[model samples]
Target chain A: MIEIKNIIKSFNESTIVNNVSTTFLKGKTNLIIGQSGSGKTVLLKCLLGLHTPDSGEIIYDGVSNKKMNDSSKTLLRREMGMVFQGSALFDSMTVIENVMFPLTMLSDKNDEEIREKAEIAIQRVELEKAYDKLPSELSGGMQKRVAIARAIVMNPKYLFCDEPNSGLDPRTSIIIDKLIQEITKEFNITTIINSHDMNSVMEIGEKIIFLVDGEKNWEGTNKEIFKTTNQSVTDFVYSSELLKKVKKYL
Target chain B: MFYLSDIGKYFIMIKMSFFKPSKWKVLRKLIFKEINDLIIESIPIVAILSFFIGAVISIQTALNLSSPFISKSLIGFATRQSVILEFAPTFMSIIMAGKVGSYITSSIGTMRVTEQIDALEVMGINPLNYLVFPKIVALLFYPFVITISMFVAIFGGFLAMTFAGVPSEAYISGIQMEFEPYHIVYAYIKTFLFAIILATVPSYHGFYMKGGALEVGKASTLSFVWTSIIIIVVNFIITQLLLS
Candidate 1:
């Protein structure tokens, strides 16, 4: 479980992530949803320890992140996996090598053992033939799949994804979202995804935190999200023309 | 805000720079990483110029001493002195400033502008330790690698003169006659210092870059120009001290 308390982050005169506190449950896909420049990414980065909050406490499983030693923090990170917006697969590596990177760098497992685990992770993602392909060789959706495989190769306890469905088609987006949902439950990991894609919210938003600008506006499930009378949430959900038609049915 | 901010900034920078890079077994790997890269990437251009400078310096010596029956013993000394003391260290560093330095700046700058560095940080990896340290470890000792190339290059001229059978023993003597171990030793020292400055400044500049493609290009250009200028200036200061 991860708990963020009074997280406040700002850049220059503009506050990007306002003072917000939230809890992410283990064994579920916890989501942060907001429009562009809404601090969803900043919140995710703060959780990852990429950006330090100006003043706040991020307590992870009873340990405060701001107070942890560097070694302990690194150990915590090794137990985590991330899929960045662009997939961020190492361009120089093949899919298999990219998946095997964390194990090679941080694990005591031998090459044969790492290879076996990496192969299984690749297979789990249903990308059977992309093991030898470079990231550039794969299509955009395929690259995200490779990124997913790499993220899970370590069998991490925490999975963080930044806009996993941002550039994919609707069909592929559903596929990726389902993959994350299934993997989250399978590993019982604490998963957090950042996105503005409403289709993704409806498909797999088991838990969602809505942000307006930089402040937390509401918290609810997919069903509750559409039912909320909050004007800002309505604006966001109805802003999508498809959701507006869907709103008529609501 | 006005007067001594630059000096104060340098002091703060010096203090922050002291976060002794994590001691890791990875540094060994970094050394091998640098050696492999330098061998594969840098040798062809360096090889082409090695013997050319060696020959030119030898020719210049021969031309200057050709008039009178110069001391045969002085021939090798002259060859060895000019090649080892001056051309070997200075010229090779100049070449490296172009080839290896530009390559480092371009690569790190591209990664910076592309948000790849941020991705690494989000993964809890120190992009500096992961990306830049290996280059530092590599280039720090890789001057020795560059030095090895220089040994071949700066002596290629003497070898050619000897092969041409122009009283070669005499040329060898001219160079050997004035051979000072400290001169070449200082040469290696100067190159080693240049490698550190070259690796750190450019990698730091690239790592902190915030803008887009044009800004990345600007960082590379700035790193190269500043690194070159520092190398020349430092080289002059070292030469004066070592020679005196």
Candidate 2:
């Protein structure tokens, strides 16, 4: 589990994440949902240690991120996995090589052992045939799968994804969402996903945190999301006509 | 002030690149790959440019020395001095500031924009050591390339002088006359210095770059400009210190 306390991040006199605190539970798909400029990405970055919050503490498992030394922070980062928005696989490496990169760089495993683990991760993502192909050769969905394979190849304890469903087709988005959900359960890892996609929220958001203007507006599950009477949550969630109809039925 | 900040950042980046690598095996592979990409792949252009520049220098010297009292051997002497002292080491690096420098900037800038560097960072890999160290090691071959350029350039000068009816004996004697071996050593020293500049300046620009695809292009351009400027400035300083 990850706990954030009074996290406040500002840039050039403007606070991007303002006194937002939340807990992300283990073995569940935790989602951060907000429109652009609402600080979902910034809050996620703060959790990842990519951005430093002006105040408050991020407790990963039990250790405070701010209190750790450089070596300790490095060790902590090694235990974390992140999937970038663009599926940022090394363009020069093949799919399998991309998956094997962390193992080669950080693990003491021999070549054969590394290759075996990489192959298993690739297969886990159902991308067996793409092992030899470059990222550019794969479709968007396949690239995301390759990114997912790379992230899990290290067997991280915490997994964070930034907009895993963006730019993907609806069907592929659902597949990726389910894959992340299954992986979370299988590994019992603390997983946090940042997205503005409502379909994804309803599909796999076992726990969701809604943000408005850098502050938490609501926190609930998918079922609770439908019943919430918060005006801003309703305004954002029911902005679409299809979701409005779905809400009418709900 | 922007440049001052960049200089400070560049030094910090160089300092960071000296950290212990995550894995020597991975870094070894990266070094070999970078040598192939940055050195071997660049041979053809360097060779072609060096040869042509040598020929032009020989012909131009011969023309300028048209006075009957001037010795024809001076054509070869002038070509040798110019090629070794400035052309092969300094001028060629300026060209590389365009060729290899822009490539380094754009490649790393693309990685920055693509979030590949972020991925490395997330995995507990120092992007500086992972990305810049290999290029720095690969450019250890920069002096090697310059040595080849010097040889080919002098040979091309010999060919051009003889083909243009300058007396072969005089030209050969001119090249041999007053040939200081230390000049070659000085040139190599300059080449090594230029190599560091070539690897680091562009890398600093690329690694710290912000924004998207358009910014990548802009960073490449800026990298070339800064690299060329620094190379020339260093050349003047080295010449004053070593030769004066």
lDDT for every model?
A: 0.79, 0.93
Which residue segments of model 2 deviate by more than 4 Å?
Answer: none
What digit string (tens of lDDT, one per residue) describes model 2 on residues B1-244? 9878878999999989978575888889999999988899888999999998999999999889999998999998999999999999999999999999999999999999999999999999999999999999999999988988988898889899878988799988988989899999899999999999999999999999999999999999999999999999999999999998
Q: Output the chain A TM-score of model 2.
A: 0.98
The list of candidate 1 runs beyond 4 A from truth reads: B1-30, B58-80, B113-125, B159-170
Query: Poorest 10 consecutive residues of model 1 chain B by lDDT?
Result: B14-23
Candidate 2, after superposition: displacement of residue A153 in Å? 1.0
Backbone collisions counted per model: 22, 0
lDDT of 1 at A86: 85
In candidate 2, what are the lDDT values of residues A52-81, reduced to their tens digit? 899999999899987899999899989999
Report per-prediction Cα RMSD to one decimal. Answer: 3.5, 1.0
